[model samples]
Target: MHIYSSHVLVCSGTSCTSKKSPELIKKLEEGIKRKKLDEKIQVITTSCFGLCAEGPIVVVYPEGAIYSNVTLNDIDEIINEHLVKGRIVKRLLSGNNEGNNSYESADFFKKQVRIALRNCGVINPEIIEEYIAYDGYQALGKVLTTMTPEQVIDKVLDSGLRGRGGAGFPTGRKWLFAANAKGDKKYVCCNADEGDPGAFMDRSILEGDPHSIIEAMAIAAYGIGSDQGYIYVRAEYPIAVKRLNIAIDQAKELGLLGDKIFGTDFSFNLELRLGAGAFVCGEETALMTSIEGKRGEPRPRPPFPANKGLFQKPTILNNVETLSNIPIIILKGADWFKTIGTKKSPGTKVFAIGGKINNTGLVEIPMGTTLREVIYDIGGGIPNGKKFKAAQTGGPSGGCIPTEHLDVPIEYDTLIELGSMMGSGGLIIMDEDNCMVDIAKFFLEFSVDESCGKCPPCRIGTKRMYGILKRITEGKGEEGDIETLEELAETIQAAALCGLGKTSPNPVLSTLRYFRHEYEEHIVNKKCSAGVCKELLDYIIIPNDCMGCTKCIKVCPTKAITGKIKEPHIIDQEECIKCGACLEACPFGAIIRK
Candidate 1:
């Protein structure tokens, strides 16, 4: 094996790529080559480091020095100061200098358990040998060599590995059902169609460790007696698609896929079918429908995918994350895998944590990890020292967890009990500055626009709820608007055709459940406490904090502010459009939202 004194792992995930990580990689390669240290120093491009806020992350191995927010200029300094000279560059360091600035000591990784993301930042995904070096296909090899199909299913079942795709179904049970079904031909399908807002768990997994997915799917095929599989991924994920294609080609070349895998009689083949970015296609039926060259829409269940699925055959469908865990479960016994998370929900969950948070990125915390730890400890608390008002989990289909339940153990059942489902792992943080009514409206608008119109509850009911929220935010809410929203939500929840329609009203319902007072403030009092709803806001000049240098008057979008040069400003409520231009213009803390 080739040995190097130092190994450089760089972030090539989507977010970092957008920030010109590729360009940064080019600079590093050029610098290392110029210095003739390429043999001594190895540079590899890997997946996300979870701390995406610090894009273009560079981690120096043997030293474990993590450099965040790395730019083209910072790279030369990193090479000269850290790589060649053996001196740590303090400026580009990720964490604080208070002893916890190092990668191992950073608060970001304190609460994270990266099982699905095990090889993400450690190895190059494009190179199949790097994956093999990390024991990537060892699980599949073990399965094909020693374990029987029944033993594989039993092991997964005993592992308590529940489906990571929104609904928390048992993974082994789903496999068993598909395996038991009598079909001339069965198919294993992967749902990489992660349509949830602020969710990128699956995308990161595919990009970081595509081989794991391939290995896991092969294991699943062996377990469920399937020979052909297809990954229904969204077309928007160009990078994931490219990596998956490369991985498949590599696996085929090594005889890991295609036919007689590992010299066994079990022969399997896989293909990729791209979707048109339909939110509804995230549903298993819709995903299958899209894969079959039809318009993406959810079909009636009872004949679930496991029984009669894609192309009228027994099909087992699992999300990207759920599949990523399969190989590990096979390698490590079920009992071993069950020891990590809670009894019901075993294993780590990858969450795409974004919005109003200090450290915004991906995190894979254990199942029973508390929201407080995930938000305060892992998320690094809210930005601008804003008080954490609520956290929206499960995206549009899930509910909002208010501050009262912040300490609740983050398990599958607990989140649902608190009125939110543990969706495909999107935990959006909301600060005190957010208006709950507007927040509800934002998600409702997404639900309304993305609705397939297959059923009235999602197609029509979501539209009605969106309209009501729009009216409420605009200071035009009626007396019984809240009651109407609740009624519509309940109806949608009951009468909807699929999981998408049934859970479509979750955002509105949950916001109404937790932040009812905010709705009351908007409708009954004609005010927005969080200053989010523009129509419900009243800007007032705090005379005590005002220095009054004609700044407010000059900067007012409308001629609302008028006062003498040395005197405190006066805001005309009638003239003020509540654009808060005067607020932005004021150097002093004078402007207040009333």
Candidate 2:
């Protein structure tokens, strides 16, 4: 093992990499080499530190200094001043004040209890040695050498860990079924094909701690008596895929993944299968079908994956986050793991928070944390003092959480009771500027576009619902439009072919359930209270605020405003395009929308 005087960890996750963290890392490495301090100081390019809004993040150990928004220019200063002179770069440090500058003390990271994201920003993901140094494969080693197959399953079952991939099925029960099933071969499949928008929890884990997933999968294979496994990942996640392949190769070379792991008779082998970015494939059967070289579409249940899956073999499938927990549970015992979360739904959940939020990044908190805490304390609330209207969770398939339900605890059962499900943890915050009708339309359109078209309810029913939402948003809604949408949403939910279809109407249903007043306003009053439907709005010049500046008149696309140089302006409502250009260009604060 190599030790250094200082270890500078730079975030290299997708968010940070997109923001030129790579360049900063290269600069830091070159600077360290140039200064002849390679032996004393080491630079490690790791994964996301979770505070994406402040990326690219740099955390220097010894003092545990965290710096955000780092640049190549800042790298030289960091190396010279912080490394050589033993001085901290106060200017580049994160947090509102110097007291909470590091990630450990920062509010964003303090609220988070990272289990799946444990090694993300802490280790060099590209290197297997760093992962092993952190007790990475110890669980696998313990399971192979000490525990029996049924004992491993019993331990997992007692841990009370559930699937983190939307559905909260008991992990132990699923493993037991797969193990008990009579088949020549049983396979373990990892659902790394995370398709939800704003959801990158799995991707970050793969990029940062691929070894965790590998170790967990190996443990699962031992428990289920499966000698082969497959990880189904999306092609869009280039960083995750690259790191996973590296981890696999490294583990095989280290005699961890290949035949006779730890010199036992268990010869478990794992392979990678890339997905085509299909939203439907997030479902287990659909994912298995895609891995079998078929089009990704849902198959009817009852002969579930446990009985017949992936080339007609018995299979146990779990997502990246779910698998990541297995190693810890095995290492730390089920009682300790169960003590962290709720009685029914134990363990932590990782969410990818985005949309109108101050803290836009990945966060993993205990299962029972309320929405208020996650949105306000952890997310830093909405940006620019915007009023938070609602938050959309579970991607297009999940419902929106209104202000009335802010204190609701975020468990699978509670979320489902609130007309939402914890679907892969995509929590998108919406402010007052966002229209509920428009929000429904946006998600409905996404569902319509991404629909596999395997069934009529989701294929045509969702289209009809989207059409009604589109009409309402365009100010063409009729008296019966709301009733029609509600009816269609119910029908789709009850009659759709798969979970994707059944849940596709969630956005519309949830919006109507909570913000039906908005729908009524659009349908009856022929007005968009949020001023979102352009056709329903009319521009007017406020007589009191107008100063005859003629700014609105000059910039109006249709010349809607007319006035002399020193008098109040008059807007020609007939010619107004409702582009809000007059409102934007008015220096007198006169132009208003009615």
Candidate 3:
């Protein structure tokens, strides 16, 4: 075995890979081998470091120095200066305030508690040996060798680990139900169809720590008395799909998966199923249906997955983030796990931070952490010195949180109390310039498009509500449009068949609950306060700033602006199409949208 004094950990997660981290890896390896330091130095590809805004992340072990936005240009410097010369490359270091180069010390990762994300940025996901080195399969080994099915379920139950995949259902109870269900044939499944907009929490886990999911699924199968398992991942995640395939093959070779695991009577085999990128398949029943070679659509609950899941068999299904916690809970003990977060919502949550924030990436913070901390402290506040207007959680099926609730603790129930659910952990921060009504319309549009059309309430009712919102944004709203939207939202919530249908009105409802005034303004006054609704905006030239430059007149497609040289310009409101061509052409800060 080749022993190396220093290890180079490069991020190869999807975000960084898109940013050419793979090229960086090849460059570093070739450079290191050229220097004849291959015997003493090792270069390893790991998963996401969560700070995706500054991706292509590279961390050198022994020194724990992290460099961000690493490029092919920066690779030789890293290899020559940091790897060979043993000197820190200060130029490319990220979050290096006051000379601190550690990832943990960076504002983005400082307060994060990474239980689910523990092995993410730390190990080579493709290598089972690296996973095993970090006590990876110890939990499964413990479960199969020392523990029984009932005890395993009990441990999870006592841990208070709720599902991180939106619904916040108790994972242990789901396992217990599956165990108690009367079925000769049973199964364990994983939900990796993460279709939430701006959400990649599950994808990161799959890309970074594929073995953990395999081990956790094996433990789940043991607890639930199942021999067959399937992991339903989206085909859109090509990298994640490839890594999961590699990890599963490695696990089977080591006897961690397949028949007689750990030389016990317990036997289980696993298979991977790819989805056609249906958003509704993120729901368990729909995912199961897709795996069963049917169109992905949700089945009404009552005979839930625990009772009758994939192929008419009793099954237990958990999302990637939820299952990722099982191995840690088994090894650390339930009592130890319960001590981290709030009582009702124990452990940490992994959120994919997007929209208007300084740090747009992935974050794993304790459940009880406040919205204030997540937005300001961890996300580095809203970008461009803009005040935070709202945050949309749970994707198209989620609601928005206004400024008033900034300090509220981000628990599963607390967010629901504020008219939002923790849907798949997509936290999108909106700045003051965002139009609330338009934001609601955006999510509603997504829900409308993604709806399976299996239920009339979701398909037809969401369309009606969207029509009203569209009219309001276009300055054609009627007086009762707000009331009509509220009525339709209530009807859809009450009547929609599956969860995708049921929660489709969440964005409109939550926005209405908090920002009702914005709706009224749009309807009654024909004004969009944020000036985002183009139809409701008028571009006026500020006389003081305008130099009568023909720039505005020259660029206007409709010849809407007219003025002499060195004099103030004027735009014909009737002729302007609100394209803002004149706004872009004006060199002076003259054009104002109202």
* Candidate 3 ranges with C-alpha deviation above 4 Å: 1-100
Clashing pairs in 3: none
Q: Give the TM-score of candidate 3.
A: 0.84
Looking at model 1, report the run of 10 residues with the lowest lDDT sum: 96-105
Query: Candidate 3 overall Cα lDDT vs. reference?
Result: 0.92
* Model 1, residue 282: C-alpha shift (Å): 0.7
Tell me the alpha-carbon RMSD of every candidate.
Answer: 12.8, 12.5, 12.4
Per-residue lDDT tens digits for candidate 3, residues 1-594, read 877899999999999999999899898889999999998888899998898999989999999999998889999999889987899999998874577687888988988999999999999999999999999999999999999899999999999999989999999999999999999999999999999999999999999999999999999999988998899999999999999999989998999888888889988888999998888888888888889999988888888888899999998889999999999999999999989989999999999999999999999999899999999999998877888999999999899999999999899999999999999999999988999999999989998889888889999999999998999999999988888888998899999989888898899999889999999999889999898999999999999999988899999999888999999999999999999888888898799889
Candidate 3 weakest lDDT stretch, 10 residues: 95-104
Q: Which stretches of candidate 2 lie over 4 Å from their true place?
A: 1-100
Each prediction's TM-score against the native? 0.83, 0.83, 0.84
Ranked candidates (TM-score, high to low): 3, 2, 1
Task: Give the clashing pairs for model 2.
Answer: none
Q: Going through the candidates in order, what is the number of backbone clashes in each?
A: 0, 0, 0
